[model samples]
Target: MLVWLSLVLCYLAFLALALAMPRHHEQLRGRKPGRGLVWLLRITGAVLLGLSAWPALIWWGNPAVAVSSWLGILSVAAFAVAMMLTYASGWWRTTLAGAGTAAILLLVLPVFLHP
Candidate 1:
């Protein structure tokens, strides 16, 4: 579903943005991230967050509802990411991998699965 995809992408975007910071990266990886890596994470996070809006536009086909839905999805995703960082920091790596795989699968599967 577009809603689910948007939520996952938003969550991933927030995770990437969080990990771009030195403290969070160090917390999760046990080492500071390089400048290049930080920049990459930042750009990737921004782009993914932007991409998450596409499904809403396609599904809703109305600017107002689409914008509101995207905002709601972002809020839920941000809260989920904050909770993960606060309470489940140890699982960051696993969560990142799983979310990345899920995002890819969601993007690809619909192409083949659509009637």
Candidate 2:
């Protein structure tokens, strides 16, 4: 479950990074994002990508496995993001919203369920 959560985070992080580019932002929304929004997206994407590794570390406990798993998850997420951008650009907002909601739920559920 935590691994799956990490995948979602990676997906969202890629999505944010992709949207930070003016061309991609315009492709999806028909206008370039403002400079402030672009910077916000870039920083948020970086932080989320970093945080995505935490789940693997928490789940596997071995640094080697955690790093490798995170990279593997990142590969899958990056491919998914590319496909989405190529074929379903119009759905970006919806996809981001759903993933964000799911990530939040995943982060919270284990705490409540385990405790």
Candidate 3:
């Protein structure tokens, strides 16, 4: 239970970082990101979400394997890519809002359902 909670918390932190990427990128580059980059961020976010959920499914199937923990670690990498894409995109505000909301809901649902 503790490990799963930690994974969820880490994922939430990554989501927050991803949400801030756009504004940070703009300040660094002195220009807005392009539409293409926004799309990239969205795709990356989706991928991270998918990867993060995989571990829980695997844990259900086989708790003996250590692969689930590795998947959780990979989620951090996926979140980094998502953040980079968000920062590179000009549509940071919209993407951040959507992703943040989705992340919160995803993290909360399991707690209530499983508790």
What TM-score would every model get versus the actual structure? 0.94, 0.95, 0.35
User: Where in model 2 is the C-alpha error above 4 Å?
Assistant: none
Which 10-residue window in model 2 sums to the lowest lDDT? 106-115
Clash totals in order: 0, 0, 1
Candidate RMSDs in Å, in order, are 1.1, 1.0, 9.9
The TM-score measured for candidate 3 stands at 0.35
Query: What's the lDDT for all of these models?
Result: 0.93, 0.95, 0.55
Best by lDDT: 2
Residue-level lDDT of model 3, residues 14-96, one tens digit each, is 54445445774465456666767756766665665555656555555565444566465557655754665656545545545
Top TM-score prediction, candidate number: 2
RMSD of 2: 1.0
Considering lDDT, which of the candidate structures 2 and 3 is the better prediction for this target?
Answer: 2
Model 2 residue 74 CA deviation in Å: 0.4
Structure candidate 3, residue pairs in collision: 33-90
Lowest-scoring 10 consecutive residues by lDDT in candidate 1? Answer: 98-107
lDDT of 1 by residue, 8-87 (tens): 89999999999999999998889999999999999999999999999889889999999998999999999988999999
Q: Candidate 1: which stretches are off by over 4 Å?
A: none
lDDT of 2: 0.95
CA deviation > 4 Å runs, candidate 3: 1-21, 27-30, 61-115
